[model samples]
Target: MKKVLIMIGNIALYLGVFYALLYLLRSTYNYEATQNFAKFLDVNPAMFMVVLFTLITLVYLIIFRIKGWIWPQEDKNLFRAAGFRRLSASRVLLMIALGLAGSLFSIGLIVIDDIAKQFPSIPALVDDLIRGDSIWYVILGAGLIGPAFEEILFRGLIFRELRRVMPVYAALVLQAGAYAYFQPSAALSVISIGSGLIYGVLYLRTGSLWAPILVQNTAMSTIFLFKYIGFYEWFGRLGDIWLYIITALCLIALIGGSVYVWRTSGNGGIGEQANGSTKGGLTV
Candidate 1:
């Protein structure tokens, strides 16, 4: 319980810092004016995301470095301790595929049309991003930088901390709930929880933070592709039966991929401790 409180405090700190920076930037720049000028120059408002995420990354590094300095032995190279490690080329490819599938599965679960309905602002935001001239900025900030930071925060740090005090299943659920709680809307919360679970599994199975980061990047990139090509609209036109069928297929693929990862993992799966210690080979 104490640990949970501390974890919550940490999450609050991160979020507070993020929002504070966002507020400062918004106050400093006239977003609407800049956006209008950007339109004239064939630029995108999504470029703001790149600046925001880059600054957040710097803040994270500085904060973690200070923590390391205070607790040298236990917290030295905190990111590495959070499972930032390398993997083979083949495994990296596998993770990417898994992430793509996971993203599709998440969409199927929610039904993209329903998502648009439940949270009108979401599709509006995506539309702005997809139609923007600085699409590369969108890709870098939303697809890569944002997901990488989230993987490190949610899967790498929070999930690992949860695992130290509870069973893997409990930890997974709690961390996913934490992820969901941070989302702005109910539809996004559901998607975040699902993706959180998938990313957590990838982190545990591969024993590397890169696994979740790569998978998350693939998932975000895939979503952007789908939105860019109007895939969601096309699929929505296919009626309820087709939606059900596709959802079923995506669910099956997601489950199969998860099973494959679980069986092939050298870390004894999620049953093992976050620190790679094992009491018994208990499967969770």
Candidate 2:
């Protein structure tokens, strides 16, 4: 029954949000021309989707709560599934490695994006990502909101549940696939999938949600920082997917190494050693 409710709740959350978003965007304009219509909503589509999910997350949670679902409270032991018990040096290294590997995987998606022009995307999505002349918005989006939304949904909600029906590998892969499907662009599927897998693996190895969020948000903020600092041209750089891929690879290497070391070295203060535990929750 809980699993059935989870499946239903997830479907409703997405469907409701999709309907609402489409309605909001389409009702005031031509539904046929999404590109043309999207101009009116000035936020980054990714962030826009973030906002969308954040809003709908309430609906999701409300539904689950009404049904007596408890989030982050499923398996008592799995909380340490990804080795998140410490703030030690090894934990930090684990986060760095995970971040780097995740970013590198996302970087590879750039090439795939180019080769598959058939994939859908819009200029505004890129604009939203790079248009952060305001540092506060960048900080809020990249630092706080991005991490919170992603961590809660990915680690706290999804991973917490999947350990029951599947092995860690299958759980991670399926969750990654779902994460990719939620991305801003169809072209981003590979990027999202790869990054999601990296994150899931990190969670599996380390057990702490905070470590991955911290590392991911850092990477995200750094990319925005480049835009904030005007290190590259906005919108124009999207066309140069190779450079993005290369830069992503370098950044990934740096961060992934840092995360791995943090996770492994017991003496390090960021995350703790692996423990044999599993936990569950259903916060909708």
Index of the highest-TM-score prediction: 1
RMSD of 2: 7.8
Across 1-284, the per-residue lDDT of candidate 2 in tens digits comes to 78757755654564666568546654544555665445533444444545554665565555555444355453333234323344446556555555545443433333344533554353234346555335666656654576656766766566656654556667778888878887777767766776677666555554556666767876666555554565445433556666565756765675466455446634522123333343332111
lDDT of 1 by residue, 1-284 (tens): 88778667766777777888878666644576565544532345456666776787678778778877886755445466567766667778887887777667655544556645766755665666555665676677678887888877788777877776788889989899988998766777876787678778777887777877887788777777776677777777777677777777876776677678768888654334345532221121
| Regions of model 2 farther than 4 Å from truth | 1-53, 57-86, 93-124, 233-284
Q: When superposed on Cα atoms, how far off is each prediction in RMSD?
A: 5.5, 7.8
Q: Estimate each model's TM-score.
A: 0.78, 0.60
